[model samples]
Target: MTYPPPGSGYPGPQGPYPPAPPPAPPGPGYGSPHGGGKTNGLAIAAFVTGLLGCFGVVGIILGAISLGQIGRTGDRGRGFAVAGIILSCLWIAAGITIGVIAANSDSSGGSGAAPSATRTKPKEVDAQKMKVGDCINDNTTASAPSTAEPVEVESVKIVPCTSPHDGEVMAVFRLSGLTMPPESQLRQRASDGCKIRTRSRISRDPAANSLANSYYYPTDESWRSGDRSVTCVAVAANEGTKLTRPLAR
Candidate 1:
């Protein structure tokens, strides 16, 4: 093969080649596709709060905000935000339904009559009008009065002893002194005197064994209002039974 002329620049054993271009700059979408965007924090919080069930309204509000942010920012957790909103709505509806049912139940007052087991207010009568051998019914006598506090009598009803009664007035004696004694002393004296009187009346009878003595004394308030009488009563030992006759002779 004849070589090109020496003075004429030409490729012989090696052919002329174009130089390599510099590497292309990294593109905008380079590196990991998942590197930039993150899960919305509010969305995660909303989902957790909804699961807790206590802050349903708050969860709903947070979920709404999270959804808007997620849509604008292209963040993750879209599913989480949606779930939170749904759970919150359901919880709110359930709470309202339960509240309504409770209100209705309370208003209905089940069967429109007071339960027989519950004690109702007894008929009211004047305490001064009470007399010996009279049958009386009182809420205070439904159960044993607490000895720690002065016995309070709201009202009383004088019923016939032949019918069922709570107690019979064994005695209606007035305190001798014009000046009232301290409540503690008065209560003690009244209780002891009434117990003695009741024992004397019932000692000969077999039914006395099934009776318990209880007495009511004037409080400071009542004494100031011109009341000084102490009333004694014998309640049935078996609370379920009612006395058929006057307990005292």
Candidate 2:
């Protein structure tokens, strides 16, 4: 090979490499790698809320916003955003299915009308408000024979005459008293008044033989509270028996 002078600039075998092309200006959008960037804040929030299932719609909105941001800014968490959206959709679908099933179950349960139509139970009424011909039942002892002890009751349930019942009101009478009568005298007065009032009615009913007269009288407290009315009821004569037909009919 020929040699040039010591101070002269000379080309090498490759003739001095190209200038390096200004380092190629770095490729477009060439920052950190896709998953190496900062994590997307909305993506984290969406994932946490979606796992709870209570904020499904909110999670979906946040996930969509995160996905858009991730595409534009090349941030991390793309998989988290997509998973959040999918989980949110699944939770919403499950909630809708449960609601539909509950609605259908309720609709099916109340479809029948026969049970409510022929119901024997009726509204309750105050015992003091019992009127003649009102068929009634109470929570006291089942039987109310003529000789049975007095029952302390606040209310009674009025039922149909055809339904089985404990008692049926035959008459109502009032006792005149300026003060509470003695217990014995009170019972006597109530018993006398009820018997006198129900005597004629009992004679007319052919089924009266199966019935017995019972009376409701006011207590000392009730008498002080301005209650002076007494009610006469015809009940089954036998203990533990329920009257099936109206005594007056």
Winner by TM-score:
2
Predictions in order: lDDT: 0.74, 0.83
As a whole number from 0 to 100, the lDDT of residue 89 in candidate 1 is 87
RMSD in angstroms, candidate 1?
17.9
The CA root-mean-square deviation of candidate 2, after full C-alpha superposition on the true structure, stands at 13.7
Runs of candidate 2 with Cα error greater than 4 angstroms are: 1-120
Q: Provide C-alpha RMSD values for all models, in order.
A: 17.9, 13.7
Steric overlap count per candidate: 0, 0
Candidate 1 residues lying further than 4 Å off, grouped into runs, are: 1-124, 141-149
lDDT tens readout by residue for model 1, 1-249: 888788888666566777669999987874343566898999998888888879959989999999999888888888899888888888899999999988897777656655443233344587656677767787564335324345567578877677787777777767778889876788788888887777787675568788877676776787888888877777777765678876545
User: Cα deviation of 111 in candidate 2 (Å)?
Assistant: 25
How do the residues 117-167 of candidate 2 rate in per-residue lDDT, one tens digit apiece?
Answer: 435667698889999998888868633775767768888999988888888
TM-score per candidate, chains pooled: 0.45, 0.51
So what's the TM-score on candidate 1?
A: 0.45
- For lDDT, the strongest prediction is 2
